[model samples]
Target: MAAAKGAGTKKPGRARRKNRPSPRERLLASATSLFTTEGIRVIGIDRILREADVAKASLYSLFGSKDALVIAYLEALDQCWRNDWQERVAELADPEEKILAFFSKAIEDEPEKDFRGSHFQNAASEYPRPETDSERGIIAAALTHRQWMHETMTALLTEKNGYPSESLASQLLIFLDGGLAGAKLTHDIAPLLTARDLAKQLLGAPPADYAI
Candidate 1:
């Protein structure tokens, strides 16, 4: 009887360990999904803990507070977006094609419901008063991501076709921004397709080459 009881307890313990997410990872994943779907302010620490299935003590131990979790979440999102784009771009041979690929992938991944705007933009709006270091860090990270897209597109335009790199880059960025905003506001993919058509015109290419 004693041996059976010990084995049962050990099994449950092992199962619990397997089921639990690491505190830091749990908080980050929870915050990312919540903040991306809902406004950051609307989702509080309690909700994060519940969604993460982590203890309040564990969250505090890992992140210290809600603000820290939010910063970490944004940082994680930044890394993820960068890595995904790099992977997608790597699949294409031409630099200009890669630029179009980036936009194409963005539209393909449009959310089905509760579609909030860009995570960076939403976070910036929520934490307008950046009195803390954490908020500043998130803002810097978000800006870096945006700047990277522009710089990358500019370099590709200059290197691939010798276009007016600065002007072309600005135009492309505006098109992309407009597409994302329109997609969220209108809940339609037509805007994305329109953006792709405009991009092809800007690049002087056939629709097949730049189809998103």
Candidate 2:
């Protein structure tokens, strides 16, 4: 009997598994697409559920509410942005090269069409309440990214170029941020190139012979 039961248990080919998307994954995918195209506030729970082809109970079970889902979506976006930049910046061993790689990555990452400005900036602009966890998380991530850029620039300036001034890094950061803002506002690549030029000038480093 035990042998028979074991044989019956092993009778199937491969065990078939359901390929359906989990409730959370479906909701997140829906929110990501909607939020990327439409502004975050404009998208509501009903629309997300309908678009995801999920029931309200599933969404509520996954995210608790629309606001929570929005926060999760932004967090996911942050991770993706950071990962892309990190990969681009990783190719060059030199810190200066890496610094320039930052701007290069920015220009490269620009959308082909319907490119709106920074998602974090846009989201924060809509939600200014610092008390909210979502707003606070976005603000914190933005600051962290800026700090990473500044620190990377500082390391390059100090280690590669031997610049002694502590303030130089912060100044470079300001210039780079301005360049990025200009690029977004003007929708022109010139500002990014200008920023690269200015970065070389600020670091007292020579222009790179090759494009990043």
Which candidate leads the pack in TM-score?
A: 1
Against the true structure, candidate 2 reaches a TM-score of 0.73
Please give the CA lDDT of all the candidate structures.
Answer: 0.77, 0.71
Q: Write candidate 2's Cα lDDT for 1-212 as tens digits.
A: 99888887842344532556777888889998898778888888899999899999988888777877877887787778678778877677777677777777766665542435566666667767677775576567556556666776777766765544346677766666666677778887677778878877766645342112
User: Residue 81 in model 2: shift from native, Å?
Assistant: 2.0
- Which candidate has the top score in lDDT? 1
Alpha-carbon RMSD to native, per candidate: 4.7, 6.2
Off by over 4 Å in 2: 1-17, 131-134, 155-158, 161-166, 205-212
With a 3 Å backbone cut-off (N, CA, C), the pairs that clash in candidate 2 are: none
Query: Compared with the true structure, what per-residue lDDT tens digits does model 1 show for residues 106-135?
Result: 688766443454677767767677887877
Overall local distance difference test of candidate 1: 0.77
Residue 152 miss distance in model 1 (angstroms): 1.6
- C-alpha TM-score for every candidate: 0.82, 0.73
